[model samples]
Target: MLRESPYPMVSVSEATALIMAHVQPLRSEEIDALTALGRVLASDVVSPEDIPDVPKSAMDGYALRAADGLAPRRIVGELTAGGTATVAIAPGEATRIMTGAPMPIGADAMIPVELTEERDGMLYIQRELKPGDYVHSVGQDVRRGQMVLAAGTALGAAEIGLLATLGITRIAAYRQPRVAVLATGDEVVEPGSERPGGAVRDSNRYALMAAIREAGCIPISLGIARDDIDVQRQAILQGLDQADVLITSGGVSMGTRDLIKPLLAELGTVHFGRIAFKPGKPTTFATIGDKLVFGLPGYPVSSLVSFEVFVRPALRALQGDATPFRPQIEVTLAEPVRPSPDRPEYQRIIVRYQEGRLLAVTTGSQSSSRLLSLRGANGLLLVPAGETTYPAGSTLPALLTGQLLL
Candidate 1:
């Protein structure tokens, strides 16, 4: 049996703004650069020293003066990588240098070994050489005192390699948030457990945990709490104590047994009780002290969609990520579809490139309980509330959730 709720619903934008208004970035922590992948940089990283501080050879060739081009020169010395030139080269003199080797003094250019032939300790050039040819000048890659990475930048493989090149083994990065997941309702049972009549498997907890991990946050499971107010209260208090954010499923709706919203009011300030969004209308947000709490719907799809629309961005913001929202792109609908009558809907769709055009096809059945609707879905097509139907070839903006198919 459903019951009426006294809380007023807020628009999606209003709810998002309200949630972000309270979010604060976590403090920075010193971590090894090798382990900083996917972590947000806390401060700008400046190059302490120029990359390739000294002029080096860019190829395995003979280093010689360009003025002596096409002139048979005697090989004065051979320099390998990490080896320094002990002697300077004069006119009619050359040094056999390997790739990445420091250029010999007075040597202004390099001629590839393939382009020349060596005989009787003399090197002959097949092609004309010019000054600065095949030579990596000082600070060619990066200059000293230059900003290499800006604050709030997410570290990736290339960033880590750059850090190593700059001799930065340690870095200051924003700490990843720890999220606590709590499953409620007496009808929920653990997976792989024998279910009695009227019992359903607890997929929401596992799904939410996976989503939390995918967002680069730690997930702590608080097990299950029955509809009992006391049990739910204790679990919620424990979650708030152990995690930076608390997520509870199955107790935010307008029902007689929906005690999470009321308990959140007693424990903290409920910023917004509901949102005017489909698949997650009963979503709730609150703040208890410094910790955040999100009450999501019980359905599997609703739980995941709510996480994508709200919790994910909050997690990214807590890590100081500059762009906390998903990338949005314009997509053309491949087929006609009816829009929701009231609140806006985020329809899951599979996006692909066909004939040089990006087209989207809706997944069958947008029901909140059907988790399969999200399978193979790469974008969420935003359908506005209207009585008219959207015809085929209608263009709309969609939030990209994954890579597009070719």
Candidate 2:
């Protein structure tokens, strides 16, 4: 029988719910539209006026009245893009218009240059043209008073272009959260430090920093914090002072060097200290004033999984993302695997599309310390508790970590 943990344990769903309940979207900031990529909009962007504002030509062709006879017509003055049409097309007359140019008066259609031949200053229509042919009507794309971009929409390249079309130089979006990453433990040293008798390089903090950046949060490194209680306390306070969210990797589990849990309880309310999940059962969450703090495992893979499961969603929620959680899908197991007895498991797996089905293949070893298991992994096989062995062809839900090869 396994020894009972002193800290109360909760399910993953409960832990996530509690964390999300305490999260509030960050305050909005006005940034230039060009720099708003990947930012969630705080307010709906309404169109001030019609895009294009007037009827424009969709092609470089002749703008002439469709009622004009098929006989040759005199080529009047030319109209280029962005220039107003000063000449009107009367009977037996056509205006050479370029793409995006406003249609000349008395012209209801455009005949593409390829469909007509021009010789001796006269144009002959070789194809039948109908009214309103090849003409982009005013407000065809967007109308005044329309919502160009809805609130909570993450701005991307297409959104930026649309905002530019709407004459929006700047946009109001939720501010990105600043995450402070602190590595703790007496045996842990900086990455460049020489490996003495019994010291391990601090890789968790650097990995957490990159993970925070990937989640769209600004990462602030708090360096390494020794296992001493006083040092850990001071580091936590400093991290809180400079960051909106503090992520400490190490010193949360039941061990002689674990000082983060007790220190957090003394400093702030530790909401929940344990979860019924493999690889990251000792994950802890707390709130110091308005800032959120996450205590993750020291093992590299555990830290990565904990951040992806808890911290990442919280960060996205702070940025007003509508879909904060990673997408989940059902996939078939390509091989047999044993499940974690009373706790759920997040086994990293490489997903492939085979015969129109998603196949899940486990990454080499599931050890929490093996960060390489996450390399090239795009999905996590979510094996629930209460099952021993799952054979191939068994269906289970999986959460996406990256792009799946489908």
Candidate 3:
């Protein structure tokens, strides 16, 4: 016999708040700076010394006093980058310097080689020069004891380059969370295994694994567990022991065989067992001794959608990201769509820029079991529960998932 779920269904916002309340950033660890790309800094990085501590030439030209304008000066010596200045310029004298070479003691400006002519060891300047022109003065780019990067800032290519320039080889960064995925059902089998009648290949495990990786978390596969309560409990226990977050699919509904909800309650606290959202109404969240557990629906589309709506943000929060949610933008619908009568829907859409406006079109069929609906989709259009049909050109807000199509 089917039994009703004991937990009341809550709105998406309520569920998100409850989950976030339990989530906290992980502890920091020292790691090599070269491997810190995409990791959030746990502490501020201050410059130990000023960038370009000495005055350097910004162009390959002659370095001389600005007072000697457009005058023929004797080129005493040549200065290349990484070579020390052997001769200093005096009045009516100049030195041939390359880009990034340290300026001599008496030189105050640089003229580009393109604007000067060299004849018989004499340099003739074509353009008038001014002091500090084409010269990188001391501490011009960065000052000493200045905060170059703040805590909670995500490291990128440019940030890594800056750290290299500042001689910062190691960094303190938040540890990436490890998520374990468990697929439960008696009718499920591995992809390579032969499928018998009434048996289906397991796709949720791989899909959830990919989604976890995309969220910047490490994914650990817990394999599939049978519908038996004892088997599911053992699997869940092992998963909790090995991972910081646990995600299970196919046993969270109200069916008699559905056992994840009861098991979670017994093992920990179930914050919310159901959401008032379509395609993922039975999604459940819980906390087990500082670890998080998410029980998602069995359908492929529903599982992925729930991950995007809930798990992704949680992972980001664990890494101390200030903006944990996906970016949301207003978009215009390209066709008519019928809203769910009882619950709000997250419809998969392909968003593109049409002329000057952002237009979105729904992937055909919006069915929870059709995983193809997510292919080439870049946004999730939020449709409110209503009896009326939303006609073409209706403007609504959507959560961005990927790059917008031009």
Q: Rate the local accuracy (lDDT) of all candidates.
A: 0.93, 0.91, 0.93
Per-residue lDDT of model 1, residues 1-406, tens digit only: 6566777889989999999999999999999998788999999999999888989899999999999868899999999997645769999999899999988889999988889999999998998888999999999999999999998899999999999999999999999999999999989999999999999999999999998988889999999999999999999999999999999999888778999999999999999988889889999999999899999999888889989999999999999999889998999889997899998999999999998888999999999999999999998999999999999999988899989999
Off by over 4 Å in 3: 1-3
Task: List model 3 lDDT by residue over 129-149, tens digit each.
Answer: 889999999889989999999
Q: Alpha carbon lDDT of residue 108, candidate 3?
A: 96
lDDT of 1: 0.93
Off by over 4 Å in 2: 1-3, 69-72, 83-85, 353-355
Candidate 2 has what TM-score? Answer: 0.93
- Name the weakest run of 10 consecutive residues (lDDT summed) in model 3: 80-89
